[model samples]
Target: MSEGFEKCHNEYTLFTKTSKEGKILIVNLYVDDLIFTDNDEFMFLEFKNSMVRELDMNDMGRMRYFLGVEVLQRYDGIYISKIKYALEIL
Candidate 1:
């Protein structure tokens, strides 16, 4: 393994809850970054607390930018659009 991977550490918390009794959900995490979706809000908070204790985390209060993608959330859903990203190619 590369030296970087050897020192890899978990640095984020994520929780997902479903309104129904049982549902399937997927969560993806990379280093200090995480992404997930669910109808349950409490599940997200519970996951956050567990992550904080283990990783000494800081909740940024919602994601503004992720992996060069800008996120704008509305009551309907999340909108991810890249601004000025196309110009950088030139």
Candidate 2:
């Protein structure tokens, strides 16, 4: 992943990328699931395509839930929660 992103002009940070255009892209890899997000849609698609070319990955569309966290996208902004996880613990 690091090498692939570097080829796309992205700075690596353990698990994040700051594009040359100053857009932030984050990727969290679990056992077999991967979740990612970016500020720019065009840049995001570009990166996604690059990943697809370099690696065998399946695009899961928009992220609705990841690692027990529920993701909510609204007109105003994005909201994330661990309500399901919390309930399980309680």
Instruction: Please tell me which predicted candidate would have the highest TM-score against the true structure.
Output: 2
lDDT of each: 0.58, 0.73
Write one digit per residue (lDDT tens) for candidate 2, span 17-58.
677778877666667666677788886787789889988998
Off by over 4 Å in 1: 1-20, 23-26, 88-90
Per residue, candidate 1 scores C-alpha lDDT tens digits across 1-90 of 211112214633433334356643335567766565545566566655766777867777767778778898888998998775655666
Shift of residue 66 alpha carbon in model 1, Å: 1.3
| Model 1 residue 47 lDDT score | 57
| Positional deviation of residue 83's Cα in model 2 after best superposition, in angstroms | 4.3
Best by lDDT: 2
TM-score of each: 0.62, 0.64
